[model samples]
Target: MEFTCISCGNPLSESDLELSINLGSAASMEEDVDLSGDESPPFALDAIDDSETMNFYSTMCTNEPMAESSTEAMPLCERCFESLAGSIIHDIQRTTRETGRYNEAIDQLSTVTPPPPPDLTALELEESQAMAEFQSVQAELHKLRRTLAEVRAEAEKTTADTEERWRAMNEAQREADAACEAARLHAAVSTNLTAMLASLREDATLALFPIVDCGTHATICGITLSSNDWAETGAALGVVAFLISVLQKKLDIFGQFTVSPQGPQSTIAIERQGKSTQVYPLHMARPTKKGAVQLGMACCCLLHTIAEVYVAQFPDDDAVSFERDGHSVDLDDRSESAESRRPIDAINGLSVVPEPRGAPSERWDLSWREALLCLGRVCRSTATLDPG
Candidate 1:
């Protein structure tokens, strides 16, 4: 009869049959055998004859049920038998190891004593203390949060106040700068005005005494009185007298002698017992010896007045002295050297009577010219002095 492998349904070789017989025997005796120990094979191959092996296989097949309806005896092939034997061995080893571990667990359990139950009251007290600590820490954290908020608010307010103060300081600084600039401008304008006023004052004083020499003639306000004509001479004298009166009034000089000018017939008066008396006529169309004497006397008085005015106006200047009854004027330097005294003889020949008894003297005209020139020099010098 042909034998087939039970697992692969292929015809089995002789060697496969032998392997299957050994595997089948081992499976059948698996419970009784100590497979983990160093033991001999389940059955010796030498002891089993082919017929007996067949009988054993058949007997195993009978004992075990088959999936097919045919009740034939079948053995596994060599390859399938090896695979099945390896799986069975592996399962047995695993089961042996699991059984050893279960036995050790049972022994350990039997030797050990059980622990006592937990103390519920102590556990509850520890839990309550932990809860209290947690609450305390939470409260402190809340308070710290509130303090931080307040600190932040105060810091913000301080920043705002500082900004306000800085703005105020900046505004004040700007206003101060503007004020300083305005003051500087005002000071500059005041200085300019002061200089202008001084210049105008100097110009006005010079205008009041506009005396100048016109070639071969002396002029006052462009009027020449150098001619010997009686009317021209009289007019010149009258102008001189008028100027003297004006100077006296301008200088605020109130004295015993005063001049009254009336066109070409001007006169000088002297106070006698608090009454005014005309000393002399300054202009005369018909000259006479008596008139010459009076003219000389009047000229002397005028020179005295001029001297007084010069002294009052310029106290620090050299003193002017009259000599020869005002026929000559001199600047007295009051020095040790007599030559330091300078004489002005512009009016020297005015008092002298002419040889022909007053045929309009050329000396008189020359005298008037020199006198005008001298007066002009004094006025120009005065203007040059510092008003201060």
Candidate 2:
């Protein structure tokens, strides 16, 4: 099936040429007097016309290019359109041929402006009105050309602005991702209470995954630790590593007790006899002078120290605070951080706010898919936390 040329109402087909020749030599014989010329210019002027004489008049009206012959209408084969649409070879050939023919016609007409001029008062008036109409149409055409150029310029500018906006957006997203990654790295080494606060804003997982949070783990925020996810829970991708302290929890919290050659002894207790403090005593034979008590006590003490460093939660001190050793600790206080005081300006300069539930958070919406693609590049993960 083929489509018709919308502009010319003509079927587009592969034809070398479709020349139109207006056989008007008869009309030229006497200006519509009669198609009667005996000499006939030594060539056919009635039954046939000179090719040059015919083609000149025909070009005026018939050469109206088919508007649908536009470059857009690729209905014409590629090589054909390239050949016909102002091909350099065709242009040179056409220019030489048409120029020679036109010059010949002009020379012939120059030698023959015969007879006295006829009074053409009414004809002159009609010609004057037609000239005025032509000038108005020409002015409108010029205006249309100017308007088209303006529209094209505006379109180009809009395209450029859109590209620049996209570039800027990508840069901002990269900075944000780098900052979030920094915060993620820092939070992993922080305490449990800080972990809870940071986990409350855990949307970073979504951007890194297609559907599931990390493709391997299920919802891990508040689930059992010793279940199937003993693997994932121990891994850093899920949550703060709280379960690793299970062994530490089993060890008593009181400072370890010691057994001397003279029964069990707590040097710390004797030192703080007046003050209120508790202690734990691990049963063992009198030191055996082998420092076994010292060794066990040291191991227990080291485990507790590690737990305090990584697993201990911040005190929710719901009481008033006082000074000891001239130190200002949160004995009991109900105030926020100084940054929180000016919450609006906190800049959150870098934060790891996780994806919101019901709807995609303001952090997720983007202008296009590539925006997030660029962000996914910065999402950092480590193998040491694999728990494998």
Candidate 3:
């Protein structure tokens, strides 16, 4: 026979999502009968054929005989199962409401009404009034006991509150103490830091002063300047070099200036330590630019000139260059020529000399003329004085 869901009438098979409810068999139902109350069985079962495994029993329900139970199993698909579950829940709620009503009826039955007092003598009535008074005193005693218990409980709560407040106050005090300690430490640190900064300022002033001062005054000149002064002048060149190196590393500017003896030629070239260097020869000349009398002086003057230009534009501690022997350079190039000529101050009166090329590029014959021309333009544009 084809089976359909009993709740939703959906066609169902073994493979489909389904539910099967197994009802108690007749044998199991017989076990529930109260045999001690009655000698006869509560239900009578009819015999079935050998092919039939199911049995049918007859029982009276509410003074009426029950209909025959179905032997075939009922199947429910997913949707039908959901609908049956809802019906079951509704039935349970209805049963619960009926149970509540039954409980209320039972409570009504449980209520007891004191029987009316028999005809009493005068002594018996007096005894009844005394007993009632005694009962009132007993109720009052019970009420007093409950009130005492509440008072004790309140005392315990108050004690706990006091202890909690004390704990909170102690914690707050600790936090305040910690804050004060931190403030003290910070003040000490600030004082120490201020002192340290003052010391560093003194040291930096002593170190950077000489280098910047010499560059600032443009006092570097070899002509008529003593050997000692020439050394200071050379130191000024080192300062300029150090500044340029820092710029190359930090900002990657490509401009470079170098002094070397060669046939008169001036050009720009890239120099590399462990890599390739490119040269852009702007102008090449074959003749020497200046005699030996002014070569060293010319170089010193050029370095001073570039240093003034650089410091004027970018005056920063990072640009401050110290020699390997520390930032101690005697900038007193007080030679007669350094004092009189002041090549940087007298730059306009100087002749155009070509930049010299080093031995490595001697064949290029770079001249210093263009370099001197460049310096002349810069000097005439700005009015700078030499320090006395």
| Model 3 C-alpha lDDT per residue in residues 249-322, reported as the tens digit of each score | 32232144333212233233444434454443323332233332243344445544544444443444343332
Q: Give candidate 1 misplaced runs (Cα > 4 Å).
A: 1-94, 106-117, 200-388
Say which prediction, candidate 1 or candidate 2, comes out ahead on lDDT: 1
- lDDT digits (tens) for residues 253-343 of candidate 1: 3243455545345555544444544354455343654444434433433443355345446556443333342233333333545222212
By TM-score rank, best first, the candidates go: 1, 3, 2
lDDT of 3: 0.45
lDDT of each: 0.50, 0.35, 0.45
In model 2, the worst 10-residue window by lDDT is 206-215
Instruction: Report the backbone clash tally of model 1.
Output: 0
Q: Model 2 over residues 30-66: C-alpha lDDT tens digits?
A: 2444446643332222332344543432332234332
Model 2 clashing residue pairs (backbone): 201-354, 202-354, 203-353, 203-354, 203-355
User: Top TM-score: which candidate number?
Assistant: 1
Model 1's alpha-carbon lDDT is: 0.50
Off by over 4 Å in 3: 1-130, 205-388
